[model samples]
Target: MDATTMADAILAALGGAGNVRGVTHCATRVRVDPAESARVDVTALARIPGVLAAQVVGDRVQIVVGPGRVEAVSGAVRRGAGSATAPAHRGRLSARTVGVLVDVFTPLLPAFVAGGLLTALHNVLAGPGVFGDTAVIDTLTWLRGPVALVGLVGAAVFALLPVLLGFSAAGRFGGSPYLGAAMGAALVAAPGLTADSALPAIHLTPETGWVIAGVDVLAIDYQGTVVPIIAICFVLARLERFFARRTSGSARLLLVPLLTLLTTGLLAFLVLGPALRFLGDAAAQGMEWLYTGAGVLGGALVGAVYSPLVVTGLHQGLIAIELGLLSTGGSFIFPIAAAANVAQAAASLAVWLCARRGTRLRALAATATAPAALGIAEPAMFGVTLRLRVPFLIAVGATAVSAALLAAWRVEAVTLGAAGLLGFASIAPGSVGPFLACLAVSMLLSFGGTLAWARWRRRRGRPIDGEDPRRSGDETAILSPVAGRRVAVESLADQAFAASALGPTAAVAPESGLITAPVAGTVSAVAATAHAYGITTDGGTEVLVHIGIDTVRLNGDGFRPLVRAGDRVAAGDPLARADLDAIVAAELDPVVLTIVTEAGARTFAPIDGETRVVAGTPVLGPVGSPENI
Candidate 1:
């Protein structure tokens, strides 16, 4: 689906744009903080095309749309929801804090990825011993200038990272981005409060720098620091808002920037900067100590939980720590992430191999494997492995072993890149061999482990991938819920239903406004919007009767439920009444869908041919079964 349409469908599923409190996206998921979590229709979300998965972690609804598409869809959602301002703090303090951090750094990924690749290139071309005893730059003297230029361009982002953080943080915190950038520039600017200042007889150091109320303020460079800049920009945002509120007109514009900058800058140099810089440093050192001191155990722990962290949206917070580690020397986290990603890909591939040909599971696994191998593992993780249950566990176990091996070999990445097979390019040249070795082990172990499990299941007479364990009971026929002209499921405009992602389905263009029970059983569910209903048959068939496409947005305007949950109803009994004209007037399709959402032990064979039908007619039944005319 197009981004705009996807965004609209997501909003409608999320209870419309008015219900979205805040929205943001990471690499593969659009994280939405809803004004009312209870209002979110997870079923509808899962039915949206291109949505790999829809889940609720804490107070946020994370819709996984895979890697390449998340940014555009998220941008569309953000615009539609009007959530360009700072995300409202709605969940746990830690979750909200992480959301804010994600907002600040997500926009910088392109720069990080580009810089990382370039730096890796420079390492190959100029770093000693990368090519025999001498580097490519040394072997070819004429290439020196271009190689030097590459190194400079590659290092620029990290060198000026604080400034970038300043601009993003300030904008996120609701302040002028330019002023925040200026603050960042001041932190990295040389000759200002340094020991060897240009101004003669004016030197600064821990021992000789200006004393602030008996405390000596040390002059420190904040070039690649993360915490300090983020903290300072937040303060800057507050100061700007404070100044702007008290001043008016021309004076407001003039005084706000001037006063906010001076006040915040002083606070940064004397208090916030020094204090937060220490905190940032400690965090970096703590991570280093964990990896170095704890050795293999630490790496295993990180690798095992990396995918889970991604699931909960906590992994985005690790970017700051990764950046910190990069500044210090190298990041061990990236190598472990690479191993974990490769493991997932391998497990997905294993599942595809075990799955029956032409089955949905095999197709999904086949499509997800390549992307997972490319470092975008959400499709494999969410769409394939996690759904199967066992493959996800196998992948995690394999990742732990591989990460432990990497730690034993002291392998690390110098910069960020694809955290899968292509990650070798980003590994420190000397550590590249170990990284590749661990990655190979991860792939082999994950693939073998999953395939072994599938074989065990087959030996036990259990289904490997195509069979649903929930399937039970005998086959039954499903009655049409509306009197209308029959329509084929595959011919519908809604791709999710057409693809049978929600199970076997048939649609009808309604000839009447009255909707009826499709099965003789209890009313399982009644949508608050009155546009949909669910009925569980006596034989245990789960059926969903949807009145119209995108009719949830009507908010019960022209729909009324005649039955409530737990009410026993016979086939053809009134379930609801929908205004077909109202649905069409709202620019939505007025097709009624009768879906065998779950057909336990029975394959749904929708009636062939597009013919007019009446409510209560048998429209779907087991293969070769006579229609109940």
Candidate 2:
């Protein structure tokens, strides 16, 4: 489906637009905060075209739709869902904080990437080593102006970063973006506030200043500072809102902006800016201490958990810290991130190489590898490595070792860019060789380890997909729960059942009201609405028997349960009786669904090409079993 259709489908699966409290997107996922988490149909979401996976992480529902496609999909979702403000009591504080950081910086990636690449270009042309210590620009004197211009253009983004941050932060905080830019402009470009110039009335050192009204207003330059502008924007948002509420009519427009700017500017200069700059400095120093003091161990630790952090959506907060570190010349996070990205790509490539051709696993692995190598790892991580389990662990272990090597070599990135094989351009000129070396180590170990594991499994006559290799002698036959025409699970109207997200599934268009036990088992649960029953077979297969599509809304008006939790059941025993006429009159589908919620060690294969089946007849069983044949 296209982005618009996908957006509508996603909104519907999220219990419709009315159920959404907020929506946002990062590099590879569209995150939604639903009004009721219980209402989200994750199974239906997973079945949507282009969705890699659907998962609930804490209080938010994240739909992975890949990188480049996420922006369009999320924009459409946001428009369909209306407002983006989340309810205060809905999510944890830390999650909200991370969301804010992601919103403010994700839009600035293009600028960062362009400037970083140009900077690398400038380094190559103007710096030493092009001809035995003579720079390329020096040898070709005509290239001097162009080379200088490239360096100048490259430096502009970092030098005026605060303005861009301020504008983005203010919009995120629900204030005027232009005014926020004004605040940043004042900090960086306004006279007397910069280190280059001071107020004529006062004599102060460039590095130090006296206290004003008990607040020490430091004379530090805020050219590329991150924290100070963000903090100032937060206050600016609140101040603008406060003024907006108090003023009215003509006074509102004129006074709100004026008072908001004047008051916020004063506070920023005398308080928040000076104070938060220290915090930003301290955070940078702390990261440097971690990089330099703890050294290789610290890099290993970061690499090991970096992918896990991405899974949890906590990596968003790291972007702010990374920007802060950039103000201090370079960031260590980028190199480690690069190692982890390359490791995941290599592991996915191994899976693609080992998987049998024409299999779903091979197709997914093949599709995910290129993106992972280009610095987007979600596809490889979610679709291939994590699903197989061992490959993901192999990638993590490889990343840890490679990141340690990078740290040992003191590799760091001067700017933000793709954190994969192409990331060398973003690395500090002196560390590019080391970055590539460590990246090679990451690729070799992850690919070799995963390929070796696959070969070992093959040698033992086991499935490379990480499934059990048990013989068919241990098979179980799951009988049809009701007498009717057998229907393919994929043909069912309910996407949750059609996707078989619950597990291996079968559907029957019931000709009778009686619902029988599909297998001899113990009842695990009986829905309060009397429309569903959960049974665990003696061989340890979980089965869910849902009476009809959306029958729970009837509130047991046309249903009767013959079983309860903890009750033992025999194959062909009546489990429930549904009033088919009442269900038809209520405009609900009366198709009975039997799903293998959990197959455990057993593998389920449904019988195909059966137009009709009697109650108590085999509908699903293990592959190679008589029932399956």
Candidate 3:
């Protein structure tokens, strides 16, 4: 469906734009911070044909659609917010560029985790005399070999991610990605040291280093490294285009790229590289001061803020924090970070435990939890916790608790990369036991906390089986025609006449029916196409019931109408008889719905799966609630 239609539907379902506090999305889901989470119709959201899932996290409610849904969802969200209040658009990259980020990060998550874990394990296996026995050594040889192989491969990709990003960004910026990536590769390959050398070997060694401009620039290996080269490559692509208009062919290529490489590479080796290294060291020192000066407070804050860092993709920059803790035995950030990572999964587990039965919320929570346990919270933070409230808070609480314990234990780490629970290996051997204990405590706190809260809310907020307390005298009842799972009552798609079917959206069939009123109301508007009608129920609930998309073209020719605008229809009174064959012949789906048009009414959802329904049965709302607002 077009964004406008979706937005209109959401606005109607939400009762009005005023009910929404704000809305946003990260990579995949639409997050809505509602004025009242209780007012949201979970059942109606689930029934939205375009929506996959709906959940609440903290103060925000998230709607999960798939990839590429962001733009449409964003548009819809903006429209839902209001046509007049256009928010600033963001993201340094376009949809396609962001898409590449998702692709690169998601598919490679498992490999990155496995590589980190195996490398850590290899370190353990080769320690002291554990594998000194001939049989053990022989058996583990192949394991380390493969581990090394995979680790190297994974490391290469992670290191070169910037290059991949550059390539993708180049395409978005209207340059050739292939050529741009090639340019980046060229700089990395320029007169580097031997394959085994940790540092690149220049034509002149340090003893014989040649001067560039005035300063001596040393050659350094770029392989399996993150530096400024990728940034320079993009700059070169733009320079190439700019110079191409003035200069021709190879000269444009040679001068621009060559000049870019020489300038950037030299500056990196002579300036930026040392600067970054110094900055990293400085950051390490600051982390040390925090650990030493503030003690547990620092750790708690770090843990609390880590998940949000990951959200902005700036978490990778925290490598210095972990390295600092590793280099200085005085800190606990590494162990605490690891524990917090695991805590996210623990929180998800809590959410799963507390979710109502048969909502599919549990299944999604389970999927996100596994990745979190492995030190990859993207799937969890972005997929699940971002959606569910209890889970997010549980993670935060766990992180704080775990970090405090880690600080108290004075846990220290020595290795790099995210290894979650197994990151325990990186901790100083003497501190391992304490770190593990902290992790366990964190996980328990997270799980128990979330479960406790979710259970309390669920029990306390149980809806009445037959009616809503918010609706009392003069409240109208919008009943379901067919007894089935309640779907969304939203706006109609502009491309389809049913945009007003469910309300502003079309209601999905829980079963078959000759659509009728769920509430007795007056007809507000009738489509000239004769496929749909708008009604204002006696209780002042405005509603729309559309037969199908483009069915207006059929012009009652295929539909038998029982009522028109201004007609007073009672609950269960048939409004139209649909010609099953003509509808099929017209190349349209036969789904029909009765929608609430007026704002501010109470809404309810179906119990579970499609249930046997009937006209006059309670379907959506009892009226005079947020659904009608």
lDDT against the true structure, each candidate: 0.75, 0.75, 0.55
* lDDT tens digits by residue: candidate 1, 1-629: 99989999999999999999887664345779999999999999989998877877668788877444766898789878978743232223543454466557656655654565565566667765445666678889999999899878867877787788789989988899999899988788643545565655666653555666544444455666666778899999989977876788999978999999999988988888777655544544554566778888977876787776654333545677889888988988889888988888999999999887766568768867865675766567656676655788899999989989998998888877667777776788789888889999999999999999988876754445434323222435677888889887788765555666566677889998999877666577665456777777657887888877656556667886766555546666678888889999998888998877667777787876449888867788776677522
Model 1 residue runs over 4 Å out of place are 1-88, 190-219, 288-295, 301-401, 407-435, 442-629
lDDT of 1: 0.75
Put the candidates in TM-score order, highest first: 3, 1, 2
Q: lDDT tens digits, residues 1-629, model 2?
A: 88989999999999999999988664345779899999999999989998877888668888877543766798789877875542122223553454455457656655654565565566667765433457788889999999999988866876787798889989988899999999988877753443454565554455566576776655456765666788899999999987876788999988999999999988998888767665555544555566677888987877787776544333544677889878898988888888888899899899999876755567768867765675666557656776566798999999989988988887888887767777776788888888999999999999999999989977754445432223121336778899999877888765446677566788999999999878766677665556778877656777878888767557677887765555556666678889999999998989998877667776888877568889877788877777666
Candidate 2 residue 22 C-alpha distance from true site, Å:
20
Clashes of 1: 0
> How do these models rank on lDDT, best leading?
2, 1, 3
Per-prediction TM-score: 0.44, 0.44, 0.45
Model 3, stretches more than 4 Å misplaced?
A: 1-139, 167-284, 306-331, 348-397, 414-419, 448-629
Worst 10 residues of 3 by lDDT: 463-472
